[model samples]
Target chain A: MATKSVAKKQVETPDGLTEIRWHGRGGQGAVTAAKMVAELALGQHKYFQAFPEYGPERSGAPIVAFTRVSDEPIQVYAGIEHPQIVVVLDPSLLSIVDVTKGAPDDAIVLVNSEMSPTELRKHYGLEGFRYYTIAATRIAVETIRRPIPNTPMVGALTRITGLFPIENVVNFLREDFGKKFPPKVVEGNINAITRSYEEVQGE
Target chain B: MATTDRDILAVTGNEATAEAMCQIDPDVVCAYPITPQTEVVQLYAQMVADGRVASEFVTVESEHSAMSAVIGSAAGGARTMTATSSQGFALMWEVLFVAASYRLPVVMTTVNRALSGPINIHCDHSDTMGGRDTGWVQLYGENHQEAYDNCIQSVRIAESMDVRLPTMHMYDGYVISGAIGPLQMLTKDEVQQFIGPYRSINPMLDTKKPVTVGPFDGLHGWYFEHKVAQNRAMDRALQVIQDVADEYAELSGRQYGLLDPYRLEDAEIAIVVVGSTAGTTRMTVDKLRARGVKAGMVRVRAFRPFPHEAFAQALQHVKVVGVMDRADSFGAMGGPVFLEIRAALYDCDPRPQVLPFIYGLGGRDIFPDNIEQAFAQLEDVAKSKKRASSERRYLNLRAD
Candidate 1:
């Protein structure tokens, strides 16, 4: 058997499935981000599942959502216990909740903070994981003129993981926005996503 | 527009069910919003507002009124439909019997949730399992795609001349209802071509043909005989359900049946499950199979007209069977499904000692490990020829 620390550092599973967990507050569009990512993956002909874990759903209450992308159809319907990637939609949740719970030692942790990877690693004790930081909230305010960091974080995720073509996310946003929002709002969100994709930094 | 060849879309089970409702284009939809189930009606409401569907969308004050309105709409020569969950279903309990007895083909999508005492708004089978005897044709789905397919197939089953009973197809609340997954959709034209048009016969409000509905039946009346006819219709429903499922499979290439058995052939021990947990159990069965253990599963997709003959035939060869019930039967011998399965398997020559496993009450998550533990118990029962331990056991319960 592998040693405990060695096992903690090893994150590979036999199945080639990628599971992601999102940390955000209520009303921050974390669930929508999970849904959009799943939708984008489905558009690329990949099997995906996205779901939110709810608890006393009040605005600003700590929320957690999950997304799983797989080559084959996903059959397990329970909550994701060990996520390979953890996306934090709310920087303030870093202090409030244990946002890194169940993350593997080699997991990628993405956060919507203005801090650099080195600074966040020092401040939040992010020692054993690959950390990526992006100013998603600032990007959202500059583009969408709102503090909703969902779209920007999605862009940052695209860069950090390179899980799929960014064009897939752009096309999804365009089609979804065409249905719901005005052209101005749609262009703004699209720019927010694009800018965040270029601006995200990792270590 | 006809969707060509399994157009895969990301959708929650609620959205998938409501999308099917939109395609069916029912004459009337009466609904009241509740947690988990509220999204199905909310999406359908938006579709109605956007003129996407021509159904009369009735926003009722409460679930009772919602069901009552549907009953009235169904009686007035319309293809009526509705959706509800948990306490909403409990509130519709009285009207459910009336709708079933009157032979109204009212379709309902019941997102299964735990009933309220402490008032949890999470997933469980207690709500619909309580209504198992309400004379409605009940179907369970393991995921979003199944929920969508079941919703479309239900319309054809309910509206058939031989079986005019209402249908309630359920997926787990939050788990399947709120979770987004890949769902293949049939085009609106394909759904229309499959179900065809609704032609209501013996409508109460028809001017040319006068008909009386739900008059009070005295001791001398045929109320008892009406119930017998309802039972006969339910019996006939088994065949109709299979026929409709086969026809649907031909159209969409997605097949469903009375019960979905996974690797049950030549297996000594098996576990029977319902709703979304069956997906998790299937994965666990695969793991046990790889380890050279003969583990199999039988998922009861259609529970209302409890497929007794089919179940007995499936389980007759097995040495031991585990019935996983998400709802407790309280003081009964075991859970409701366990009792039913036990009764169904009584006459088998080598009768399997069916163990009762109550699990997932009040939205407790049933993981693959928990399922593996159940299979281990089933293996133990298989090894020991005599009865073991308690008659009823709870899986994944934290005793601490």
Candidate 2:
């Protein structure tokens, strides 16, 4: 007899889970973003899991990190083979890696790019899929005075999935940054998140 | 202060284990940086640097010196801990037995990784399995939460009166070490109160009662008796492990046991597994159960004591058993876990047909499908009442 005693939870999203795979360089915070999204989901009382695929890579080498958000305990610990959403923190990774390798046709593909999603869809011929583009790097540079797009991409992710309220994401950032950085640095990241949340476009 | 919030945080297995270390606040933490295991030390070092913990953070040059330094501190009656993996653990081979034999209650977190020849840095039980008989009580974790909890409980288990043995807790290198998951955090006060204070026995620092540690044994010395005493401590550790786990459950409301048996009540075919792969095995078992197959899993949480009686009792009803070992013992009849499981059930009146499967070596990914295939093989064996075709089986292997 199976003991099914898991306390059911109500999350903001449908389908019970939103598994995401993030593609980025070693120095870029794809792993950090994956962790942050998992934290955001946890803060909202949802179950989540995140992890990075580590290789013998130097600073600029390509990497992949994965995150899974669910209303129930996640049992899968293997690497993500088929993600419901693929978020590319590095647009340069597109040419080399198959960013949408095992994604279903209706999977959402979010990229940190200067080009619009419609143009990106036309360029990549991503038919029968949801494509999103956000100028996260530009937003980060404008607000945080750096090129790290992870924080901005978090904003875009929250906005796109509606997984958690943007305020909750910002509040998590505020607490996380407040512990490590000064108020000004925290504000810079908050602005980056809010700006990208407003500017993220999808088709 | 004391935090009663019990808020869940999304954290990597390394980060969660380190947080438990910080909360425990040992006297010394001596560790060297190594892949997979490096992040645990790095996070703990940051905690020490930021004054979150008073643990004397000793940055050692090599894994050997790291274990040596902890041995010295632990002998000096200081609560000491460290973290290492793979080759680093291989480097600390000489001192591992020394720590255990000296009856030092030191705790070490071994992020399980493959000992290298091809220089791979991934999840496997090779390193810890290599030191299986080093006399330290070994606890394996199946997820980030278990990793965190084991780190905290290792202290109390090691320091227990009846079991003054050094303890090593392990989780899969990249799978649990690098994976991020949500886990509840106990306040600093809760951990401090749970672990309490460390009481030293035969401490080197007590000049008035000066005693020798690691003294040479002559031809007529009681070295044989010392070895027997160590074995006694290991046997005593089983009870201490259960006691500590029970108390921890009362404090956190989350209980852990020597073995995690899932859907095994009336199982005809079952799999015995360890570490993070058990999570995958459970999912596969659930899927098979849905199809009217009585598939079950027993995840061995405590590997050192082997939990022979508990395991034998759990497998009483099963007709076929599959023992999954992530690390293989070359030339041996079966893997380390398989050998132990077979030995545990040796005296049963009607023993189950046990099959040994070697898998996930060098951090190879074992998906749910691979686990299902293993269960499928077990189902066939259960149906036929015949032994599996191969003496040693390898799962998820690629053929050229």
Candidate 3:
């Protein structure tokens, strides 16, 4: 609950079952992000339930997709209220939604923001939660050549939390993308994921 | 002077009626139970264990699955049944209508209970009211005797070749389901002859003539065609209700169809009611008539295809019609009964202005005194010519 922004080092707890809530507009591959993560965990032999909660939502309307991974069978049925981690694909959404409203004090926040964590707090006020900022759009554009931030943010989430090995995350992406996309697109996404993971600055 | 025939031995109404359903030997029975209705499934399981009823009882996880499995079993052309009430009934809303739309002819018994905000597990009409328009023919049983009798007849009505839409038999969850009283059961041979083996039109699982089920389709394509076909089948079911009720009554010696009236020969004021409330309302009408007040009772036994002509005739010469409902329609001009009763009177040249009184909600005990109170409320409405609330109000809301 410290007020200062600082990068976090590689640390492991006994069992930190990380849950990720993705905030994006419709048709932004946010649900695809959730599915990819679920597929990743399944390939790694870690059980997960990744699902989208939508009811007649229109395009460009804000939507949230969810993912849960744990050592035990998940019994809690309610949607993620206070997420351990939050991923915002669109930086423009920060002004409209208070994404950090119910974020736990010990939670880690990830955003596709170029704004410094200090500047972000001065305007948005981080409320002293640990957070990481990544320019996923920039990474997606430079490496993947697409506006979709799903793969790049997956990399940021993987690097920031070290929720699992980077190789495992990459391997998951390769397996999931291989069936659908061409080899070039898959390789480009893999590059974007790796680059975002390398650049994600955590607190 | 005791007859050795069927009479109530001491047992809970839920246990007795559930055992009766098991006695019918359903091919598939899937259910998810709410408060008072849980014992219905529990008794069915016990019957299954004791080898009294030989049927594959699928103890499903949710009321959703309870209905889902019934749809599958019924589509596979099995004589299937399920039981639920309250939130459980609400949860099955999606599939409940599907069973009818597919014309599976499934029979469901709503061991009626109160719906929740602050939940109560007692007898009321709210549980079954949510499903009034699932195209399923809805029937209400007054007491435990009717509960036992109707569960068997319901199967016959639902699965009959003429009436292929689903059917729901509703009885008060606690008032009937929990109460134990003098009950009579139909003999095995009698029930067996009444409900013949299932003969379905189009079964999905049969390999000899297999047809696809539950497929997604284009609106102008397969979906629209199947929906239109369902509408025609439901119209046919309206006639079947009369056909089955007549035949069953002759066989069993118990009279039931819809809208049983009590002494409305030439009354100016008629009270039209539904479910167990009709029984009490009849007593109130009797007391009112004894006091030199012109009063009569109309008991609505069926709630679908809504005995409109029959119900209207019951109110032929009545000046004022008091419609009392155990549940509210919420944000409508009248209670659920008030809407239909008023609609029935809409065409008559000299029709009674139906006044609605919503009462006995959430299984709040509606006694003989409560019935008189409802009559008084209706009198006040008739005098004032205005409703207390256009939006539904809690009938017996205790003053805290």
lDDT of 2 by residue, B1-400 (tens): 2343677777788998999999999999999999889899989989988999988998889999999999999999899999999999999999999999999999999999998889889989999999999999999998989998999999999999999999999999888888878778888898999999889998899999998888889999998999999999898888888899999988888788888999999999999999988887887888888799999999998888778998999997799999999999999988999999999888887888889999999989898878888888888888884566649878999996
Please report how far candidate 3 places residue B315 from its true position, in Å. 1.1
Order of the predicted models by lDDT, top scorer first: 1, 2, 3
* Number of the top-ranking candidate, with TM-score as the measure: 1
TM-score of each: 0.95, 0.92, 0.63
In candidate 1, chain A reaches a TM of 0.93
DockQ of predicted candidate 3: 0.01
The positional error of residue B349 in candidate 1, measured at the CA in angstroms, is 2.5
Best by lDDT: 1
User: What docking class should model 2 receive?
Assistant: medium
DockQ of 2: 0.66
Question: lDDT tens string, model 1, A1-203?
Answer: 22344346444443868899999999889999998888878877889999999786899989999999988889888888779999999888888887767777778889989999889977876556788899998999999999899999999999888888888888888999879999999999999999999999987
Show pairs that collide, candidate 3: B8-B183
DockQ pick, better of 1 and 3 = 1
True contacts kept of each: 0.85, 0.87, 0.00
lDDT of candidate 1 at residue B198, scale 0 to 100: 92
